[model samples]
Target: MFVGIIVDIISAINMFTGQVIPARRWMEPFLLHNQSILGSVFYVITYGGRCIQGATATILSFCRVCAVCFPIFYQKLGQPKYIYTMQVLQLFGGGVALVLLWKDEYEYILEDNGLYSVGSDETNADWFYMFVAIMEVFFVVVIVLNNLVTYTMFRLKFNKKNAMKNNGVSPISSQTNQEKQKRESGLDKMTFIVCLVELIYFAYIVYSLQINPYMNKRIFYFFYNILCVIYSTFSAWMLLIVSKPINTELKRMFLIIGGKRLTRSISISVQGSRDNHK
Candidate 1:
């Protein structure tokens, strides 16, 4: 869930920074072409938003682990409306800050100094990249927590099953060997796939952080942001694929796409059968 929220926040910020920031020319009509104020306002919004969202992801990740490990306690706490509300407030507050900064028309001005370099302080992209780096910290932390929990769950489950079998008191002893194997195999496969996608996301974050410092070169920055876009969208796509409702929708889509010739995947069918049996 932490990763999911991070995915959403980063994607939104990336969209604004990539499309809205560099396209200041198009925004001039909206803000009367006040370039300094525009840059200041957008920079604040982009970076501030990233910071708030990153913090939120860290909190959410901790909450998710607690909930999963202590289901009863989590249930007793009731709904998570307050958490959602806080996220909404973060976004609103960031937006309001941008508006106030823009209204004040704040911008750093240098006196007629000795000289100005090609990439002057006014042209510094580090502010933007600094926020990106901060956001990536959340990504790394959450990824670490997620991988740890997932591996722990797998280890415990595997060990318990093995111990039970060795003691000749297996939980699934009543079931046919083939059925037990199928169920176990499905669980392992699903968990493996989820972990693999997570590793991909972590790799993308690392790649972005490594390249962020060199964003001034047009070709390098262009390709970097392009990768960011792809990673953002693809991560969402992978999560949606695993989401129960979304998976249902995807299967339905495939059925339609295949025009009645496509059968449901074996795992899905088997899971459905177990659900019906229960």
Candidate 2:
């Protein structure tokens, strides 16, 4: 997640430089000469970031599955070493995939209108298109399957709880059941949100695929770049929203800031009163 954020930030800067700063005469030469390098950077960051995000989604799905289907083993899965190893492996795989899929020979050229554009070889472009299409399908399928499994687990748990209530389970057991239900409810909501975002992202990928590559409109390119940044950030934003601990910490931070401001205001008012008396 941290890597994805950093990559997205770099992608944003690259987009800004390419789209907004190219008009400046002083920057044109430097920009033109470095366009290919920037293009490669953009390519790696954009696609690599997507791969990272997809891995994150996959990991989350796996954790959700473990929590639901194998709760006993879930505690073992939470070990720091296990998680770190998984992340390291995922990143290594993503990096390798990016290198294999990226077109290193592509060049960026200066347009007559003083803009820099990345030019891809036709063969490489087609390969990238196919790669993205396959990845889109794979991600969509995985997320849908995860959602299905999660929903099934939720239903089973719900029915079991109802059955226990009807059977007049002990008050202690009932209280425990309620607490479990609350936790499961939150988890269900979070999983739903994650699935929803993944579906939206899948649609965006399809849209990009269907659109003709020959259009070459600046607006289209700009919006596409914006979408890429959004794609990288959306999952993290949703995670933060659905995470209780993060939300609580955020509220606490805001309250602290607000308290400081309030104290400053009171001090200023007191000082004004003192001046008036003087």
Candidate 3:
């Protein structure tokens, strides 16, 4: 996810700079000769990022299900090092496959109106769309199924715990059960949020594709590009928001920074007042 963000930042910089800066004599030859390659690289980066996001969300949902349904097994699976290793491998493999498959789908074309744009070959474009549809379906199915399983397991556990309490179970065991329930509930909510964001983003992609044939206006094209960028960026933000630990840490960091600044300001004000009085 961090790597995806860095790639996106670089791509955005290259995109805007490439447009605003006039083509130089030395650069024109390279651009003209390698436009297709450049287009392929961009296409891979864009869709590769989406693949990583989808995979991350799916993995998270699965982990939530495991944690709720099979606590004992999840103890080993949920270790930070193991999870991080899996994430790294998943992203690396998915990125390579996407680049190999979709890189050739994009081609650079110079229109008669003197505008240069990246155009997709009709056959390859259809394949790309099909690939995206498959990914969306896979992600949604995995997330929904995992969420259902997690919820079912949580309910069973909750009821069992309650029955134990009624049977005069120790207070410590009841407290531990309650804590476990709370943690599982948080994971469930986080999974739901991630799934919701994925669905919304998928819907937007479908809507845009349907309206694309009728969008001949340049202003609409500009807005479409902006929307693509926003959607790509929003995925990372959604992950951060859905993560309880990360959100808590971010809030704590912001509070500490603000408190420090306030204290410094107050101390400076007091020092200035004393100096003036002296």
Candidate 1 lDDT at 106 equals 35
TM-score of 2: 0.75
Score candidate 2 by lDDT: 0.68
C-alpha lDDT values of all predictions: 0.50, 0.68, 0.63
TM-score pick, better of 2 and 3: 2
Please name the candidate that would achieve the greatest lDDT relative to the true structure: 2
Candidate 3 lDDT, 66-122, residue by residue in tens: 777777878998589987786784486356645564556444343333224354566
Please write out the lDDT profile of model 1 over residues 95-157, one tens digit for every residue: 543544434333322223211111235234444344455555655567457646745764675
C-alpha RMSD by candidate, in order: 11.5, 4.0, 5.7
Off by over 4 Å in 1: 1-41, 52-60, 76-135, 165-220, 243-245, 253-278
Over 4 Å off, model 3: 1-38, 78-85, 92-98, 101-116, 169-183, 200-255
* Per-model TM-score versus the true fold: 0.51, 0.75, 0.65
What's the alpha carbon RMSD for model 1? 11.5
Worst 10 residues of 2 by lDDT: 105-114
What count of clashes does model 2 give? Answer: 0
The residue-by-residue lDDT of candidate 2 on 6-112, one tens digit each, is: 65566567566655565333466576667676566656655666666666677668777888888998888869987797687457535854675455644544444
Clashing residue pairs in candidate 3, if any? none
